[model samples]
Target: MSFRHLPSRALIASVLATVMVSFALRGQDLREADAQAMSQEAYEALQRGNAALAVREYRQLLEAHPEMVAARANLATALVSLGRFDEAIAQYQMALKEEPDNSSLRFNLALACFRKGDYLQAAQRFGTIHNGEPNNVRIATLLANCELHLRQVAQAIALLKPLEKSHPNNLDLEWILGMALIRAAHPREGLERVQKVADRGYKAEAYELAAVVYMGLTDFDKARSDAEAAIRIDPHASNAYLTLAMLDGYSGDENGAAEEYEKALKANPQNLQARTQLGIIFYNQRKLDDARQQFNEALALNPRSLLTLYELARVERAQEHLGTAVKDLESCVHEDPQWLPPHIELAALYYILKRPQEGAKEKAIVQRLMAEKQQHGPEPSVTGSLPPSP
Candidate 1:
């Protein structure tokens, strides 16, 4: 009921109404006071560069005033600053629950998801925000990025094409679309387009993308050069070092790769990719125990990483733990059947162990796949042989 229409009918009603009005007024004053104090605390924390403390205060404010949108938004921002991605996502989701139609909240949630590697969810969330704000460059760029990670390269291309046209000569869009094209299997066209952008002083990101494309195309020297250029552009770019390590590994320079990976880890201690790459380098160098340790460490950080599991299984096989290797391989295959390398390794292991029946079954699968490849005629070479399962 409207406050103006609230009845003051009887003696008890009048007393209750007065008490209720006083209580409501006092509650409003208390909320205002609390909000002011929290805001001041947040500002002070920020000025002191104590992001973690700011996050705590903002979180407290949010807890006490669930409907305070400003507190909630600032809390999400603080969570990001603290690298608390999951917490930030939760807070953004809570904010969205209260304001479901808020595009900004949705965008923030998408960004949090992206940081946490939930690209598919991020892509979907960004797509919703894009629908609401079609011309938002940041949202569009993020959606394109999410599409690329989700391997929907064609969708990324489609999303960026019009944006590029509307804002002609936008280097960021051009280079992004170029990478999407390359990932989508149009390397020649993609490289040519990206080269144009690279020449226009959009060098660092463009070179990094070029490095990845060169790696995909098996042009190791070119990959190394571009990766080096990326490093020159940003001395502390962990990605450039890690990618260079991959190039070294692929080119059979174990020691060089190890050194590059060390630099990568030095630059970013949380570089799981670098750690995994280092593990594989050690594995290839016949350091089974070291490889296993690295894989274990990486798995501790990301339990669901099938690559780490596969690597551990491979290391176990190398150490002659056939049963353990098989168990891990089984888990890997069960989790992700489309990963062809694990299947090939599993089949090869069965063969090596003289389990002819099991070997025959796996052989049949590979042979069938090979037959299909032959039927298609002139299939592309599968690069980089996987280590045999011990």
Candidate 2:
């Protein structure tokens, strides 16, 4: 060929070099050995959090030794660090199959299950681990969360009772156990337990939780006192103010509730719960425009707030805006069909609107939910006599 028309030798040489390199790397025993060594190196690297390097090594090792449990477990942990929970779960499964009783593997598996939103499976695995090491705080916390999600309040409380003995001074353990007790319908006992912490001067937050517990127990005087104590300690505690407002509302002091909600707003201008409570207070006091204003303000803060939606529906109903009320109530029902108050209010609103059949159906739903709640016990009376206004 003429030199001018000849192929570029450099191009041909580059392709040939790439082909030879590919062939040399393809299935060579030395290459496989090197990969295994690198995987081991990656496992060590993971201890130092070099996730990128570890991923490459472990992936190569897995290609050759697919059944290696140590490699698989390390890979799973590395996958977790890489935010690959699904892949981590698959790897953890393989490790668990190899060593069925590996607690660490099970613990990781449980966490992975939780991250995947497979809470039931996570709860079961956590329960098993808890049974083996009953005093493990992490597992207990996981178990409690699962129980709460599943609404197995009694089981959660029972699971936590033993933890109280071992972790007597653990603040979180006590708080969780107190909440579990309250959920299990022992609000009086729960408040007492929480008050013990508050009395010990832990923080104003304990007093706040204690106030909520007392409210649940219908011990309004104590609830008010505890809530006030929280406010006195930390004027910025919005929860304490919100709790006091609700307690006042339940005790038929709409004006007092409104004032407490105002204080709550001063502490946290964006407190949607307080705003919604203020709306409810206004609604109860027949201040229709003010109620609507508060609800609108709350909705502006959080368009998706369930309480605000429900209160807006209530305010609409009271204003005789039947269609708008129906729409708002429908939204609330869609958001939280399990909350008794909304269903009851919806049924009442429908009846008032002359939709007797729809009202009856809603009333039936309320009755069903009430029956279920009754199985727990007579509802604790959050309503109690308020001390004459100071």
The TM-score leader among the candidates is 1
Superposing all C-alpha atoms, what RMSD in Å does each candidate have to the true structure?
A: 9.1, 11.0
Per-residue lDDT of model 1, residues 286-378, tens digit only? 988889988998888888889999999999988999989988888887898656677788998988888889877776777776777678786
Q: TM-score for all predictions?
A: 0.61, 0.58
Candidate 2's C-alpha runs over 4 A off are 1-85, 115-117, 131-145, 170-173, 196-206, 217-238, 247-275, 282-290, 293-314, 317-380, 383-390
RMSD of 2: 11.0
The TM-score measured for candidate 2 stands at 0.58
Residues 334-372 of candidate 2: C-alpha lDDT, one tens digit per residue = 888888888888898888889999999999999999999
